[model samples]
Target: MDASPLRDPTIGTGAAAGGPAPGRVVIDARALSLTFDTADGVVHALSDVDLTVREGEFVSFIGPSGCGKTTLLRVIADLERATGGSITVDGVAPAEARTQRLYGYVFQAPALLPWRNVLANVTLPLEIFGMDKASRLEHARRNLDLVNLAGFEKKFPWQLSGGMQQRASIARALSFDPKLLLMDEPFGALDEIVRDKLNEQLLKLWAETAKTVVFVTHSIPEAVFLSTKIVVMSPRPGRIIDVIDCDLPADRTLEIRETAQFLAIAHRVREGLRAGHSYDD
Candidate 1:
């Protein structure tokens, strides 16, 4: 897969090594916490969480199941409110950011409308936003092509493969051109082969768009492969355990996974998870 878009001369993580300078902060969260009051009792999903995501960076959140990875992503998207602390998306409140359409969210499932063809599905957000038919169609076509789904426009969601449906979902997310893309395990259901292909496409897409991305995944390899930074969290009552920087080549391929640097980063991620996990739980 041509990774030319992400190619850079630098070989390591820091800007001192002549790497690209850091972009302005796109997401800033300090002492962020979320709790739920259910019929049974109080459930703390997150606590004392702090994180920052900058423009054009691929940040992944990884931990065990029920570790509040999705919850944290949702909080950033304004789908769930933080009970305490502060978070700013693009220097504004998440709710305000959502109102301004500062980010596009992709849930675990493709969540495409089964009845609508791919073109219509991709254009649905634009249609809801009161865009003209011609303009929405143009945006839909451009995004579908961006995701390599150009000719599948006439196919309904049911007619497409699972991977294709997810690609359509990604197209729908990109159609509106949001500044940040928030994905929650969008490829978790796919087999290994399909997942790797989508990961490659996602990296190329990220390189081409330069949009900030915050992804949630349980797979350590997936997190390490695609992220410039990996945030490891504790099992429920999720707290940031470790934040590992990835210094791999910008033009990295799946084969990079076998390299010493990649394995070292993956090892650190594994150690962080082990440190935070409790077998009893």
Candidate 2:
């Protein structure tokens, strides 16, 4: 794995259209730190972390449970405020970006309403945003198809498998067509076989949508397989330990996991994780 991540070509390159380039900076964090003042005393969640996620990139934050992987994602989503330093999404504050509907977030659980069917669940966000019923249904149908849940729209949450329910949750997050997708261990609960299949589908969906994804995960292989850039974080008082660039080709399959290149990247991630633990000792 490369120590420095690869820069997206569209970043500096000029766009033919008068609009901003496709790969402009989407998320920027500088000396970012967050602390939780609780009854148990102060909890340092993040410390002096600097990171940049470009437009249309798949970036995964991986670390042990106590690390701030999900915290970082929450910060980006404006679910939690940073106590120190500065951060921006689309060149604006996270709060402003959030108010502008700049991003959509997916949590660890599917979180679909039991009372609502797939199509209704998917279009719920649009309804809250006051989109017309017809347009909301149209977007719901298209996103359901994107997640391979087209015919299952009428199915209730109880009727679908765990993976299918998660897909519907994904569709809901995408209903408003957000520029960035913030996922916090979305597939962490699924069994290995189902997780792998969903990973494949997710890659295909990302390729088609080109939405900048900031994902949090604990699985090394999952992080390597899904991310163009893998950010490894340290344990408590979390900080970045390594940022490994996944040099593998974009169009990949499960079989690629057996390749030497794949193992090499995984090895680097493991080493980085080990190093973080050692530093904590």
Candidate 3:
């Protein structure tokens, strides 16, 4: 599905606002495929999947359950190996990019240690990287503030609400200052009101940091609201069904979802999902 005609021409490419210039590819994948050797049989998780993520773009992958969205993200993070074709991150192999700390990944869960307080949890990665105590504390505090968790340093994971815990997780991911952020449905478990609030916060965070983001989600509105580009995928042997450019206003609010233009883009995304057999029996 071609969505270029729907793109707003007035929107700038975001280079002037400290965002990465257009045409700089952060992720390049060609004919990428992955298969699992199961005891029952070989399972194809992805096939001939080609994708490109430009610098500073908030790209979201939306698909049905079991469609390899997270698998593809893991491949880019070097957490999973592709069985065929080639892929690169920051113009280098995924492994090399990971070794260089080119990206930070936030999983579905907060994944914070229960025994540690928010400050200690956020500083854990820096601690592992051999950063000094003073420097680690500084980084942790700064990121916590960035995520609006400045006063919760002493609170343990169990002490905070679910949304706050996820914010702490995000702060921990940002502690190392990676240029790219990979998120796998980080707000999937939150209540609708909390999810909406976090979605808004996440967009602001993306803008302030000007970081390239690759997100995985199953929600149409969430994907449309948060993405600069939305990748629609097919089932099991996941393939790119459509890549829709979402040129909505950079500083959009949740209220924008009610507008005609927003609804139009969302309609296209729904059509793409339908075309991909996302609702097949």
Candidate 4:
């Protein structure tokens, strides 16, 4: 399906004079650390890390491989436990926030079931929540439409192209209407053309849904383009190297990426990555 805006424009300035506006802190971390114990000895994945994501913000985590970009995301999702320090989602601990279903996660791959059609796949979570069939179907249909997958509801995963499958994954994530959306390199595997298209669509989705998004990406351009705030991390024992607040206008087109402002931000991200490498050396 072609990329298109799913709903009326709903983009709003994320925060005002003070920090995060009142009651808008969606994800907060302080001196967060994680370490792994193996027979080979101890490995520190994260150290003294801190981050805060406000409501209606699009935040991207960028770093080199094994930099703990994904690990940090998993920490927020409560999929992985931190060995030390603290982190919270919506004012509660990660585990507690998870129980409250405060967020939805989209992995690197679509990870959709082969047997379930698009609609069924999107509705799976609602079904798990024991929502009535009528309500679940309605919710699924709405989300599918939001992803521009309305006509493909009856198609199976294998029947959809990689980009479409990822869109379905997004639809699935939105079905529950979670306040936060955490995407881990959702378009990393697609061809450049497809990836660019999905990126455009994702921005539109973010604007319309007005949900806080935490995305993980290795692409500097992608991170610079999509993030309202970009968090750069260092290698092993991942530590936040920089947190850049993007100053671009909310209503942006792909063409904006060619402008000096976009290039400047991208350069800063590049510098942060280079600095990380220097620290490692």
Candidate 5:
């Protein structure tokens, strides 16, 4: 399967801005905090954090190391339980959401199997769930097209560039069309050029699919570029310092960064981060 644009190139942008929320609170985290009972006493990874994401919205959490951005994401995904607070998805517990496969989780790496071709990699989840072979292949093909990788479906993971591989990984995540997309530093390892392109494509994908997104990242510009809301956090006890709404237009391009409005918002987010901020130079 090879991908082609489904509608007008701009078709993907409207759903992100025009549609009413899908009427689902995809993630609700109230006073979320986590602590590990280590021999050296407790290490507080997060404290008193509150966040709520409606379906089809793109939200990003940005903070310094030890500020618990990843910790919060893990808690919401139910990979780690909160030492305090609550998380609900579709009015159900995070564990229930996990068991029902109500979301897709993307880690820092592409994590594609080395031996599998792109189509095969995307089909892996279906196999695990015991989906029928014909349906599995059909779903995988549609997903590959969704990510604009139909032509590369037969290529092995190693043959593709980093950006392509990550796109394939994202395709796999979307094959089931999970309601929420949980991303932890998905673009962290790529170069600036590759990262920017991926960010644009991801925004387009989100707009088209209307999937709720909760992304964790350390980069302020990255947060500012893709998020409707930016949650900034402080270190030590790891508390959220501020939640800033981004008022930029949804039709973002690299040129948007050069605009004053974009820089201004990014600046404010940095101020919220304060001493732990990156890119002060």
Candidate 6:
């Protein structure tokens, strides 16, 4: 949970995007492209992408193996520099906001500290920022409750199940209460059962907090269920192919995955994924 509590609440109250400002945008990207000059060749990880994420929308990125899903995420997080174009988070440069701890990023793995207890793990970011013990402790308790892990705070990472550990990681991320959350395949290693359970909790958290999330995944059904919008990308000089708005009825439950509209959205995402996979460049 490399996050600072001063940024956002453990859960926010935002109900829509374009809400933080009167007429301004929360996130904006214009003709964004990122190319890496590796010895093998110039890797065009992203190209000519124009995207906007409102203050509290949930967006997902899905595509094939080399489609630049994670790369695009990194660029927005300011972890990577785009070769061209511009990206701004919360109307500020990503680099500055990131340095200021504007949001917390959850990568593919939990990456928790084994030696630390669950509470300590969640408080790691605050510790780095020089927050005192009493303050971090109180903040950690609130986040643990947000993720439904309040009783397990004293347990070490090794003491928890995979699902629980991931939950702890999420609590760690949210303990700082960032308005924007960037996740790169955070559930990629879990079983379907565990993944589904986490999905329910994630939606609940999103509803409670109204935080903006940008998730990267290769799973069509997962993307369809969790996102208000899905951005499809293609590989080989990876570029955005389409940006589809998910018009599914809100208040989605696990059962919603089986509904007609959900499946239809899944079908559309699959078609897009297939198209991205077939492209050589």
- Candidate 4 clashing pairs, residues 3+ apart or interchain: none
Candidate 4 yields a Cα-based lDDT of: 0.87
Candidate 6 lDDT trough over 10 residues, lowest sum: 1-10
lDDT of 3 by residue, 1-281 (tens): 11222222344343343323464678999999999999989888899999998777899999998788999999999999999999999899999999998899999999999999999999999998899999999999999999999999999999999999999999999999997899999999999999999999999998777778899999999999999999999886788999999989888899999999899999999999998884647
Steric collisions counted per model: 0, 0, 0, 0, 4, 5
Candidate 1 lDDT score at position 248 = 81
Q: Model 6 off-target regions past 4 Å?
A: 1-24, 279-281
Q: What residue runs in model 4 are displaced by over 4 Å at the alpha carbon?
A: 1-23, 279-281
Model 1 C-alpha lDDT per residue in residues 126-200, reported as the tens digit of each score: 998999999999999999999999999999999999999999999999999998999999999999999999999
TM-score of each: 0.93, 0.92, 0.92, 0.91, 0.89, 0.89
How far out, in Å, is residue 178 in model 1? 0.4
Across 1-281, the per-residue lDDT of candidate 6 in tens digits comes to 11121124323344233333222245799999888889998988988888887656678999887889899888888888888999998878989888878788888989999999999999999898788899899988998898899899889999998888888888888877777889999999999998998988998888787677889998888888888889998888788888888877657889998889888888888887777676545
Clashes of 5: 4
Over the stretch 1-281, how does candidate 4's per-residue lDDT look in tens digits?
01122211233244333333433567899999999898989888899999988777789999998899999999999999999998989889999989989899999999999999999999999988999999999999888888899999999999999999999999999999998899999999999998988898999888888778899999999998888899999876789999998878777788989999999999999999998867544
lDDT of 2 by residue, 94-151 (tens): 9999999989899999999999999999999998899999999999999999999999
Candidate 2 lowest-lDDT run of ten: 1-10
- Which model, 2 or 5, shows the larger lDDT? 2
In lDDT terms, how accurate is model 6? 0.82
Prediction RMSDs, each to the true structure: 4.3, 3.7, 4.7, 4.7, 5.7, 4.9
Colliding residue pairs in candidate 3: none
Q: What is the lDDT of candidate 3?
A: 0.89
lDDT scores in order = 0.89, 0.89, 0.89, 0.87, 0.83, 0.82
